[model samples]
Target: MAAESRSRILIIGVTGNLGFELAKASTAASHPTFGLVRDSAFSDPNKLQKIQNLSNHGVQIIKGSLQEEDGLIEALKQVDVVICAVASAQVLDQKLLISAIKRAGCIKRFFPSEFGGDPDRTRVSNLDHGFYSTKAEIRRLVEAEGIPYTYISCNFFASFLLPSLIQPGLQTLPRDKVNIFGDGNVKGVFVEESEVAAFTISAVDDPRTLNKVLYLRPPGNTLTMNEIVDIWEQKVGKHLVRNYISEEELLQKIHETPYPENMQMVFIYSVFVKGDQTYFDIASSNGVEGTQLYPLIKYTTVSEILGGML
Candidate 1:
């Protein structure tokens, strides 16, 4: 079924920053969105409000915890496209998601949550997080089942680097001090959240994106952390401190942070540094530049992403 003709698009873990944005983008185009929330407590209030904000715009809020089979079954009812937007949902449990979708049996397409790093990398052989491993498993199951699915390998979120971390959240940092995990010159792809959402919506809307890793990301231009730090400092008119912390130091300091989540953040960054994960040339892969994600394709450059933030 074409996306617009479908009754609704179901977004699992809708109460997240990216999930909500994807729903809104689809709904804005008159495509009804069905969002499955894990539960009340796990749901983010701001993201919830964002959905309510779209109430008039045509979004269906379905309360379903990923832990409950009935919840997944009910949430997916009438869903034509399923977008898995969860973080750290283990591979074992992700089976529950796919099984439920199979039970619903109407799901035509799905977008896996492989949002960072290339799975083709040898470093991926050692991927440890429940997030990476779960996505890997889900992809495997989809292939085995011959279910229609799209694996979105977004390079990295630009916001993840600075606003989310590399700077603590609890206190206003004295400066946007950046920690360079690699040689401050590694060229890596980082995308803005809106750009990611736009590309995601386009993925489901376009049929050619199915059964492919619709690597929908912003401009492939990558910038070094040092370059960004320098520009932000210059634009903001202050020398935001730059700390060259060792991998060992970061691992230790992550424990020091009050946020328990920092531990995972540290590990993800460590993988980004050590893994063979980098930007892909989308124009060459799957034709995302032309047919899959034509209009929503946004390319953000290092200087522009940083300078705009400043």
Candidate 2:
């Protein structure tokens, strides 16, 4: 195993939120970084701008896709590591990626698109959730192919969960009220996106993380929903009306929700309200302390995130 700086890194789905940040971090580390984008992504103004930004930062843009085997294999042949940051909806498509990686035979490390909770420890009943199930499938595929890989169980992304719990695009606390799933007592790990990216890049060639599930549970970032709300209240100096959605009600919604976005909400309810995300103890013998690996990186806490939003 070699340091990530010495490895040629290719990040798939570089136009995405996590992928974009990862490409930036990889380039910052002076790794020869390449970003994989679909040929069509260049046509859209927003995606094109993101691609251009990565290009400006010295990321070589490779125009190909997981679906296009020949082009993907050719793109992968130049890299030692491949990090897939594809969206949840696109998780199943990684099968094509796995095939390409095997065909390329040059990739020494492969990171699948799992930057959330530990799917291995998730209960079988909840495994059917598209988000977790697809991730599980990809993990199995990666293992079956014997690809040297790292699986990151980053819990929740603070940027996503904070705004998502209330409303998308609303970066502040709810004005008058907020929904509290269950009793808000269940604790879950939350990691900042940039920190996750930094850790992933650092772990790219770290032997300890190879073929291991890297859990991103920095002590400061692990808190229950109640604690998060209290911190928010303290930061804004206002008590929001707490509307509690019981476990029973959320389970019913999980069963009944038809819309994809609402179904995603149901999945969130499954994770937070039902306590599915915190099933594993990261401090236990099974977990790897992420902060211990890179002591210099000051991981962001909920309060810091809230303060920045204010």
Candidate 3:
């Protein structure tokens, strides 16, 4: 196939919420969007529903698994842009995505599966079970190669904290309650998943984001959970529960469970209660700093997001 214009984008993991949204936006924008589906899926009806919904949005689905080398390579050949929206826990599969993009020989840009907290030196250790290392390794391999890559180390997804809203129970850990890191004053960029896709495409479209580890960050209005709860208390019209936990205890829980979901629990236990601002994003919210193209991040507030959802 002849090389197409910059408008063509192939978004892998298209069935997921964020991927699905990006595909729709890209399609609405008139950019041809393709979705990659794993032929051997390990899920259920809702997941299938999401995938079927993609077809409704006019996204082309290429059935293949990241584990299938031949299949991945075949799918990569169909598009110039590739977004690995696969799960971070699938560290092994990430390597395959990179290899497939290379094998296709048509890919001009490759967006890795990283769409979460900063994996930079400061925050990587705090990321859930092995996800940080997996992301770091992928980024390392990309740097060594000549492939154009963008690592959107988008800071904490605000929506990821929705559990605390429905089940205020998570906001306070009764067991070995040592909240936040130290004094519970660490600030982090809390960008919504929706904003992440937008920022990602913006960063990817501008050639400057290529080959660079562009940190996808929310405009930091950094506030502790205690501070945030005060605002929420007013909104929910109830006394919000808040607590402080030691980082050491949180790490101990992680040491005990070591499961992805548990690791996330440890993180939530740490961030909201203890309120650590140790994490920071490299991508400038003002403009794409240091590169030729200026990339600006649009920050979404927690309340604003919840309001829309409710």
- Per candidate, the number of residue pairs that clash is 3, 0, 11
Clashing pairs in 1: 38-65, 219-299, 219-300
**Which lDDT values do the candidates have, in the order given?**
0.64, 0.81, 0.61
lDDT of 2 at 144: 90
Candidate 1 lDDT, 1-310, residue by residue in tens:
5544744688776667777778787786567788776556346677667667656567777777667888788777767888877775433566878888888888888876666665544243332434455566677888888788887776667766544324444333235555566556544557776667777777676677777776643433455556656656766788765667665665566666655566444544544455344444555554344224575365565567656654
Evaluate model 2: give its TM-score: 0.90
Question: Using Cα atoms with residue i matched to residue i, what is each candidate's TM-score against the true structure?
Answer: 0.77, 0.90, 0.79
Candidate 1 — what's its lDDT?
0.64
TM-score: the better of candidates 1 and 3: 3
The TM-score that candidate 1 achieves is 0.77
Itemize residue pairs with steric clashes in candidate 2. none
Worst 10 residues of 2 by lDDT: 163-172
| Residue lDDT tens for model 3, 105-137 | 888888888776545453435545565677778
Better of 1 and 2 by lDDT: 2
Name the lDDT of candidate 3: 0.61
